[model samples]
Target chain A: MMCGDEYRESLRRLKPEVYYLGEKIESVADHPAFIPHVNSVALTYDLARAPEFEELLTTKSHLTGEKINFFTHVHHSCHDLVRKVKSLRALGQQTGSCFARCVGHDALNAIYSVTYDLGKKNGTEYHQRLVNLLKEVQAKDLFLSGAMTDPKGDRSLSPSQQKDPDQHVHIVARKQDGIVVRGAKAHITGAVNAHGHLVMPTTSLKEADQDFAVCCYVPIDTPGVIHIFGRQTNDDRKCSGCLIDQGNPEYGIVGGEALIVFEDVFVPWEHVFMCGEYDFAFDLVERFATAHRQNYGGCKTGLADVLTGATYALAEVQGTVGASHVRDKLVEMVHLAETLYCCSIACSCQGYALPAGNFMADPLLANVTKLNVTRHVYELARLAQDIAGGMLATMPSESDWKNTSVGKYVDKYLKGVADVPAETRMRLLRLIEGMTCGTALVESMHGAGSPQAQKIMLMRRANWEHKKRLAQKLSGTGESRHD
Target chain B: MPGQKRRVSLKYCGSCNPLIDLSRIGQVLPAAISQETDLLFVSAEETNIDTIIILCGCPRACGNKETIRARALRCIVVAGESVDAVPVAEKDISTAIIKKLKPK
Candidate 1:
């Protein structure tokens, strides 16, 4: 358990190679642009320490009786999946943005189960190695950013066929002591501030992709690793003096993303969870995807709840709350938002225990939840924008309002229906603009794997043959269909 | 490269229509449109427009034929529908529609 301030202070000690706006970042914790996201992550630490949330946010380690942050704890039952979703929703409401810790949470659980099965079959010690690593993470209460996506230059070609082999993370060199990896992970959330990273392969691989099928952990400051911070919409506003333009000023749009470059980073044999285990890659990928997809149901719905509240408030301020059309629209938004929440719960309810004795969500339902999320979230955002009105897009910047000569004119004309000030309306509109139209939507669409990815999974997993057989049986075909 | 700027009024219908923001149009058009355009009305339409640039509301609505007709219309060098929302690999009926509506 750790306090928020302590967590923030801890990150300051590590010298991560971080670049932002084309220059190196020496202090990640204190930078204005990074501070909000850092603060969002720090809450995960703080919640674990709090007595009220202890059960939901912290779990006792099976290896050691020591209490560890729930993010690092492997799921022991369906209750754990439920608890994970509840914890994520609570954090989402608190931060109103991505905490950027769940990736590592899911990745660890994935490797935990897959490695256990792999070790049982191959007589390998990956499970024991992963448990040892988990114990360390629990003991130290460290933040682990899970890195998955690679640069993947050509979408049409496989990793082995790519013109630039380095485009996908792979084992560039191997030695008796350990293996060395060289490549970059793109859009890695909170990579710069994370204490360590758990790097996993992006997709299932073939024998040809053995070199690319690697999973390992490395400290953020591991030699030859560099992090370049990704730019977010209106991110420059974080450094600006005014808070009006910075929607959810306490927590920015999302946990800042970074390009994590691993250049010949060495991992000891003990730290390498999987090396050249191509078959186990899909297991790891599916487990991680299910857990992560379930997460979208919680976090995004929480954000949608906030956006709904904000939009409803905007309607009130504009004196449109009484309009039947507006009320219907708001109701529709709630319906869609709640449907997503139900999907999360549905997946959680359908979760089953892995061989490692931890519960994992059902893959089909999890992917369906994420796919529904892709469309409904956009609809929710559209409804919010509609309710907020055209003012959301046309609102003048805070600077315009702050200008001396025109400030009075802006104040006079931009004021809402009644008691609400012009500045307040403008700020609310800006907040809606930030969440509805910008990077937030992109995250909703692609964060847990885009809509098409989930559809592919759904199509494959669907029991179409059973349905066809049922129809044949009813049509006097001698019941030839098998379950 | 033609000096005569072709005026293509692009109006979007359905979900695609609402999503077409000025910034996206600004970002995507320069690479596709060599000639200057005028009065590109990117409005959300409940019904299809007769003009060349009628973006369908959803991918399902504009099947394979519609996509083909839009491509054929590319020859007009005057007005054309840029169906960016439709996935390129769709072999459904929209392709034929696109081909039939080719600019003569």
Candidate 2:
């Protein structure tokens, strides 16, 4: 796999036209606003090279028998699934943000297994085609953004029912060599700074939606491709003035998302994985979502550790460190954090292998894990804000703190204790604020298929008939209790 | 962009049982001190990083930073809420509030 330095230098070669504000991004690598998130992804490359993290971050490729970054390695056994989460957690903690690879990690794994079944049914060479591309990805340490969510024009309407057909990404036309695709992929994570886009259908499909059920890999710089970088809260803080104003100048609020428009982009036959596979599209979505759901268990928990730590450190800096309630809250935070980890491990541990040999996470437990995260990670942030106090919200901007005329007076008042500096106290609160509010918080709720999505899976996985029979047997209204 | 700013190597005590949330300091301190200094987190295997800023959730400060290879210029250990006794395992976790008995 390419090392961190190589990865950073590699981006210089690709010139994807990424727009932010009104201007086009000339150099994605050096752009101040994009650098932090870019750095976070680069850290993944760096961490894999670390001696201690090598075991969790690097694995052998099943197809080529070459050592590959765990991000590219297919899960050959249940242990591989479990190890995947561990690696994600390790990197999440290291970056204190999203590394931007896990979505693609799950996407590649999901597509790997699904194509095997597709090949068997259609007698196609989809599996081998994907395997070859993935081998190159591993050797190059390529970054991929899984483009799944679409901009559904109307919530109540299906893809086919949309007033504007392009609201959902679809096949515009088919050619002898390949096909042309059009429409936008919304909230595409790491798209502006990725080597490739792993495109897939966002939802289940019907016969009418056959044109919408398109999936393929497209290079980010494909002709007619347009990337509009999504705006992030306090993003400008990273650019001109004080770096401290940017809550995480090092990582910049996890993987910065973008809206990518595939304006009649062509995909060669070699790159097209699925097209017009409407009957299986929904299954494709289910496989992708379930595979992706298992990530929150590890990544968010890794984030939770940081959230929990922030609460503790800030309390100490403010001289309000030790209170009984504070202790209880801290304890609760750890309990919730560990609980999520347990769910992730349980799901991975119980995963069964597919015919393609990669093991997908247990759907029920994966859903269960993400559902807990939707609540627990929020609570973790709430408790953080609680311990850190309103100062977390009301703290002066870093600019005010650095202002020559007002800086001294501001520092004099905000000072927490004799030993700890006022800057330290306020900055800690800002970090808490950055992680707990706005996009960060909402991402937890909606990302990886929201709370309702998990509930639907749980209900489907529930053995209601068996459960009812058990209760009936106890009441002597059904079959005997003994099996 | 200041030249020759001093650096602080950050360390966090494990989040077992504590009065304060320790990780917040690590999160906020970097930005707080960014104008005049840099904060480098010294992982366990890392050594000779800089002055260390040790954040402990509570007073007990269960030994999570002792193993860091970094030799700080000076160590800033911030401990949070000092309770009389540390609970071995989230002690005093009763479901219902037990009121003090009133004498008749």
* Model 2: DockQ score: 0.03
Using DockQ as the measure, the top candidate is: 2
In the range B1-104, model 2's lDDT, one tens digit per residue, is 35544455555443333355444444555555553333333443355555555555566553324444236655555555422232322222111001101112
Docking class of 1: incorrect
Q: Which docking band does candidate 2 fall into?
A: incorrect
Q: Per model, state how many residue pairs clash.
A: 29, 17
Tens-digit lDDT track of model 1 for B1-104:
24433333333221211112322443344334433242232222222323344443233332223532353223211112334442333222234233434345
Cα displacement (angstroms), candidate 2, residue A232, comes to: 1.5
Per-residue lDDT of model 2, residues A1-483, tens digit only: 877778878887898979998899998888997888889889888877764455567778877788888888788888788777777777767777778888888888888887888898998777888888898888887989999999989979999999899999999999999999999999988888899899999988999999998889999889889999988777777776576667667887868899999999999988888888887787678888888898888888888878788888888887776888888999999999999999998999999988888788899899999999899988998888888888777778787888899999779988887898888877777777778878888888888887998899899898899999888978887654355
Interface quality of candidate 1 as DockQ = 0.01
